[model samples]
Target: MPRVSQAHLDARRQQIVDAARARFASHGFAHTSMADIIAESGLSNGAIYRYFTSKEQIVIAVCEQGTEALPKALTPEAVAGFLEYVRARARENRHAQLVAQIYAEAAVSPPLAAVVQRQLAAMRAAVAELVPESRRADAAAIAEAFVALCASYSQQLAIRGDLDPAPFTAALMAIIRE
Candidate 1:
């Protein structure tokens, strides 16, 4: 057997993360298992463990990835890009269910809760940067409200299967502008 380089190892780890995302999104955190990740990733159990110690760690990684990827989906020019992405995703019925599921699981899982908090903080920081110093405090409050609104809207769409993001976005923009 040959030794794999750090790059190969990193790639393998990313593959595991990607597989975990799909499994967690589909089956949820509690239902998803190490075996499930291994099966989905097509990597042996031993190889999988080499990258991550446990399923919980994988969940954290996925959440972290989501947090990092989200900002890239939006531009600084458009302060509401994140909201628009959420609205479009809601309409497509993708990612919203997964987000809701993770949010539910985070309520019970301490590690997940911490990860979610950190992600939220990062998002708030990004939003805060877009505002002038004089209005930073107000901007932070508005960002919090925007997050709460999106979470509520996502939950509604998930449960009721009725998504009307236009009105919500309009109202949110009005509030931000004011």
Candidate 2:
């Protein structure tokens, strides 16, 4: 057996994470198994475990990726940009469904719930920094409102197949500006 170099190991870990994202986005965190990830990534069991201890860890990583990957600024222009991003992602379908599934799972799963809450708090803190000084006190509230609006938009897209986001974003910004 040959030894894998540090760089090779990091690259392999990234491969596993990428595979997990696709698997979780398609099959969902609950239904996706380690073997499914193994098949998706073409990585051995040991290689997979070398990067993550369990499915929950992989899921947390995916959720972190999703949260951290979102645009940070909350300005009107940024909001519009994010709306477009969300709309485009909605068109993709799979990843949006997976995110919704993760939200549902987080509601019942205590461990996952913690991960979700933690990531949301981090997102709020980041947004808080970007918020104007006058709005600092409302940063957490604004963050909550922003998350709720996006979730609602995602649900609407899933249920109604309607992609129009302008009205929703406008209304949300109005509320935030109040």
Candidate 3:
């Protein structure tokens, strides 16, 4: 019997996820099939299925990829860093087209809707922590506004291939300063 290390398992899973992300980004969630991902990964059905049973699960993983670009802390500096990160991604047209695709699909998919709701809540909580205690009542709304703005910026990149971002950055800083 051979013992496979945990790192090996993680790497294998990530390999599948990376392939799924590329396929989904290039062709979108609705258009990309599991077979496409399997082919893209150059792995067999059993190998890819061993990691993700369905294309929806793989889409969720792709959604999870962008979460890291969000701020880890509630500090103003971290928020600024997050804005810059979005700006950089927008300039690149971003790997996050998959995220926008998820949003579009979430309207019809309950599982995806729930995933998005959970992530949005997590983001709101993180942003709320940055506000003063007395003003926290508006934190959730502000967080949603920030997310929506970022989403629009990301979507624009898909068409234009570049976003000026100065206006969006000013608006994001205003949200934080408020």
Candidate 4:
């Protein structure tokens, strides 16, 4: 058999992750099974298992792949734009729904919770770095609130359907600017 290139291997792994993401987004993680992921990816069971030994590992991969969209600097306009960008992606792919589901799953699953806490800590650290010198004293608190607000927005988007991000952005800015 011809040796598969690393790129090909990565692509196949991504394909599995993508399928699992879609399934988990549409059907809660608990509801989505390995069989469902296999069917969704149109790949054999062996192929899926080859990349991820279990659904939990695939869930970890999806969580690890989440994008960090924090603004480069702390500013009202940048924050608003970030919120809008999140809303757009949520509408396009229902990724917000997936995140909301992950949050729920993390409540009961210790491993998932650990992965989520790590990601949240990283995001908070990144956001804290963007705090203005004047607000440096409150950077940690602000970062915590900022990250929470962002996750809240995702939860809102998932539960409330498409919403005007302006209000959510306004709320976030209030906490940020305060």
RMSD of 3: 2.7
Question: Across residues 1-178, which tens digit of lDDT does each residue of candidate 4 receive?
Answer: 9999999999999999999999998887989999999999999999999999999999989988886577776677888788888888889888899998888878987898998999999999999999888889999999999999888888888998887777877887787777
* Model 1 C-alpha lDDT per residue in residues 102-164, reported as the tens digit of each score: 788789889989989988887766655655555566988866776677677777776776665
Please identify which of the two predictions, 2 or 3, would achieve the higher lDDT against the true structure: 2
Residue pairs that clash (backbone atoms under 3 angstroms), model 4: none
Q: How many backbone clashes does candidate 4 have?
A: 0
Taking all chains together, the TM-score of candidate 2 against the true structure is: 0.82
How much is the lDDT of residue 91 in candidate 1?
A: 61
Clashes of each: 0, 0, 0, 0
Please give each candidate's TM-score: 0.81, 0.82, 0.83, 0.95
Q: What lDDT is reached at residue 89 by model 4? A: 81
lDDT of 2 by residue, 80-124 (tens): 788778778767745567678778888887888888888877766
Using TM-score as the measure, name the better of candidate 2 and candidate 3.
3
lDDT of 3 by residue, 1-178 (tens): 9989999999989999988877887888878898999999998999998888999888877777657457665455665677667667645545657667888888888888888888877876776666657557787777788777767776776666666666776787677567
For candidate 3, the per-residue lDDT at 110 reads 88
Each prediction's Cα lDDT score?
0.74, 0.77, 0.75, 0.88
> Looking at model 2, which ten-residue stretch has the lowest summed lDDT?
65-74
